[model samples]
Target: MRVIDKFKMFSIGPLVPSAFSDGNDPKDKSFGCELFDKSEKNYHQWLDSRPEGSVVYVSFGSLAVLKKEQEIEILRGLLESERPFLWTRRKGEDEGKKKNLEYDDVIIDEKLGLIVPWCSQMEVLCHKSIGCFVTHCGWNSTMESLVSGVPIVGYPQFSDQTTNAKMLEEVWGIGVRAKEVEGIVKREELKRCLGILMENGEKGEEIKRNVKKWRILALGAVKIGGSSHDNLKKFIEGL
Candidate 1:
C-alpha cells in the first residue's frame, strides 16, 4: 500500500494516545540504562518538596547542538527568571568546542535547579511542580505538553519546530515564542518569554487555562469510544 493508504488503515483520529502521568507505569520509574542512580534525586520527590507549579523544565530535544553563546544565554535566562528549574542535557551534546551547551561551567545554586542527562519527559510534564516548559517545540514534546497541561516557552530551532511554535503561540494560545536577536535568543528576551508563561499575569493565566482545556480534550480522546481511541482500534483491526 502507498504511505497514505497505509495510514488510512491506521488510527490517528481526534483522540490522544493515553499519554499522561498517573504514576502507574513502570516506564515512568525507568531511568533508561546505567545512567539512573539512587543517589540522584527523584523528580517526584524533588517536585513535592518545592511549591506546586514552581519549576521550569527545559529540553532542546536530542539532535540540536546549540552554539556556546546561545547556551550561555539560555542558562542566564533560566537563572534570571529566579524560578527553580530542571534542565535535561543529553549525553555528548557538548562534545565539540564549537557546537554545544556547556553545562559543566555554569553554576546554579542548590536552591535554584537540577541538571540531568536525561529524564522521562511525560512524567516530568505531568508533575504538578512543573510551571512551564522551555522547549525547541518538537512535535512529540509539543503534544505531550498540551496533554499534560503545561504551558510552553517556544525556542524553535529549525524545520517543523518553527511551525509548531507558531501554532502554540498564535493558534493554540498555549505559549509564547522567544524573539531572536541576530541568530540568538538573548537572555533578556528569554527571560521576558519565561515571565509571560510563569507569572500570574493575564497572558500567563490565559495560556495556562488554554493548556488545561487542551489537556482535558487530549485525555478524553484516548479513552474508550473516544475519537482517537476508535481510530486506533480501527487501525488495529485492519492490521
Candidate 2:
C-alpha cells in the first residue's frame, strides 16, 4: 500500500497499526537506546541548569549527514535565534581532514547551547523546559514529539520527512513549515524560521493547540479499543 493509504488507514478513527515510537514494537524500550541516568549526568545536569521554557532541540535523525558548510550554517541560524538550543552533531565520516575539524573544534556556549553526538530524544521532549523542536520530520521523531506534547518547526529534507511535515503542519496542526526556505533551507532562512517558531505569534499558538488535539488522538490510538491497540492485538493473535 502507498504511504498515504497507510496513513489514511491509521487515521480512520482508530483501527490501524500503532506506530508509536522509534521502535518496531510499540513497547520496545531499547529501539533507540538512551543513556542511563548515571551515565547521562552531564546531560541531566545541563537540563536542570537551564531555565524553564528556554531551550530548543535540533536534530536531523541518525542516517542524515551534514556537510561542513551545512553544519556551520545551521549553527549560525541556531545562534541567531537567541534562544538556547541543544544540537546533536555526529562525527562525520570524512573528519580525518582538518577542515572537518572546524565543525569539531568550534565551541558553543555551555550555558546557552549544548552539542552532543547523540541524546535521549524522548527524555528531552518530555522535559517541561523544551519549547520547540527543529526536526527533519522523521516519522518516529515526529511521533515522539507529538506524544510528548511539544510543537515542531519542520525543516523537511528528504523522503518521508516531507510527508511527515505536511501531517504536522496541515493535518495535525502541530507545526509550522519554514516556507521561507523554499525548495531548500539555508542559514538565513533557518534564522527566520526559528524566529517565528520561538516567537508568540498567532500561527504558533494555533499549532500548539492543534498539537494537543493530535496528542489525544495518538494516545487514543494506543488505548484498549483504539485503532493502534486493536491492530496490534490482532497481529499478535494471528502470530
Candidate 3:
C-alpha cells in the first residue's frame, strides 16, 4: 500500500504539480496522456449552457458508497438549494435499492440536475460554469478543487478525508464542513453548509478570497520557473 505521507508529498505540497494544475487550458491535451475520456456529450452540453460561476458540482469520489438514507439526504438538500447541479453517481453504487428510492428519478429530471456514472472530474472542475464543489474531501479531490479555485462543501466519510475537511474549513477557510448528527449528515445541515459557502455574505466572501489566493499559488507552483518546477528540474538533473 502507498503510504499516505508519500502520496501527499507527490500529490500536493510544493514538490510536484497538482493533478489539475494545468486544467484551465482545455486545448492543452497533455492530460489525455494519463487520463481517459469518460465524459458524455450531454454532460458537455449541460456545462456549456450553464452561466459562468453558477453550477454546483457534487461527487463523493469513487470509493465512497453512501447508504440509502445518506443519499436521500444529499438529494433532498440539493433539491432544496434550488441550484443547478451536476452530480456523479459512480457505477455499481446504491445497488439493490428500489428504483424510486434510489434518487434516479430526480437525476433523470434534467431541469433539476444531471447525473452520470463517471466523468472526467478535472474537466468538470475546470469548466467556467462550476462555482462550488460538494466533495468527499479525498486528497486528490481536495487538491483539484483548490487548484480550480472553486469553494467547497466538504462531506467527509472516513480516514484522511476528515483531516482534509478540517483543513478545508478551519485551516484554509475556503469551505465548510457539514455537521453530522448521529453519524448522519442531515439535509438541513447539508443545505446550511452549502449556503455558508455559496452565499455572498461576509464568510462566503472571505472563503472566495482565500480560494483565489490558493489558486494563484497552486498554478504558480507548477508553471515554468516556479518552485515546484524548479524542484522537479533539480531532481531530474541529479539523476
Candidate 4:
C-alpha cells in the first residue's frame, strides 16, 4: 500500500489551462461553485450603518479556529485603522465538544466596528459598499471574493489557504497576505496591508484591473458553450 501511494496514477497537465476540462475524477463534479442572487433579508440596514466606501469584512473560513489572542490582535488592528468593519465571530457548536468559549465583546463599540456571531457572507460581499476582505483564503471565500471583484487581505490559516494566497498575490494579482502568521497578528502589518488593498495606490489599481478580468472569465466559464457548462453536461451524461 505504501509503495502504491508513491506511484503516479494519472496526468493533470491538460486540465490546468482549461477553465473546464473533460476529467472523469469524482472531484470534477464540484468544479463550478455557484454564486447565488441577493438574499431577501434586510441585513443591509445593519451593514449600511457604516459609511459608504468603507467597512471591511473579516472572517476565517468555516471550521478554522480564531485563537483568542489572534482575535484580539485583529480587533486592535482594525480599530487602529479607524475603518468601519463588520466582523464575524465563530459561534457554531464545537465539533468535538458541546461547550462554547466566551468571545471577546469589548471591541464592538460603534465608533469603529460591529461584531456579529455570524454574518451572511455572500450577501455582504455582493453589497455595493463593501471595500475589502480580511479573509482566511479558503477556496469558497476566495471564489466569492473573485466573483464579487473585491481585493482581499489574506490571513491564511491552514490547508490550501496558503497556496490560495500565493495564487491571489503572485499569480492572479488579487490580494495580499498578512505578515503575521500563527500566534497573533500585529497592528502595523494589518494596517499596512489594509492600506495597500483599499487605497488609490498602484498595487490596488493593478489588483482591481486583474480581478475585473477574472470576473469576465468567470462569466464566460458559466455561459452556454463555455467550459464549465460543457463539463456539467458531460458529468450528467457520465451518470
Output the number of the lDDT-best candidate. 3
Off by over 4 Å in 3: 1-30, 33-41, 91-108
For candidate 3, give the lDDT of residue 31.
38
Cα lDDT for residue 51, candidate 2: 77
Q: In candidate 3, how many Å is residue 8 off? A: 16
lDDT of each residue in 1-239, candidate 3, tens digit only: 56955444433243223443453454432234323335443677889998898788999987888887888888899889888888877744343122322345654356667766567777788788998999999998898788778999998999999999999899988899888888889999988877877778899899999999988888788877767777677666656
TM-score for each of the candidates:
0.81, 0.76, 0.83, 0.75
- Cα lDDT tens digits, model 1, 1-239, are 69978558554633223332231233342224433322234656767777888899998887777887887898888888898888876644233112223466765654677666667777788777899999999897898788778999999998999999999999999999989989999999988988888889998999988987877777677666666777777777877
> Tens digit of lDDT per residue, candidate 4, span 67-162?
767777887888888888877655433311212223455425444565555556766776667889999999888986786677899988889999
Query: What is the C-alpha local distance difference test score of each model?
Result: 0.75, 0.69, 0.77, 0.69
Predicted candidate 2 versus true structure: per-residue lDDT over 107-210, tens digit per residue: 56566677766777776776767888989898888988887778898877789999999988888888877663334567787776666556788876777787
By TM-score rank, best first, the candidates go: 3, 1, 2, 4
RMSD of each: 5.1, 6.2, 5.1, 8.3
Residue 224 miss distance in model 3 (angstroms): 1.4
Clash totals in order: 1, 2, 0, 0
Error of 2 at 71 (Å): 1.4
The runs of at least 3 residues in candidate 4 whose Cα sits more than 4 Å from the true structure, single-residue gaps closed, are 1-42, 49-51, 91-107
Clashing pairs in 3: none
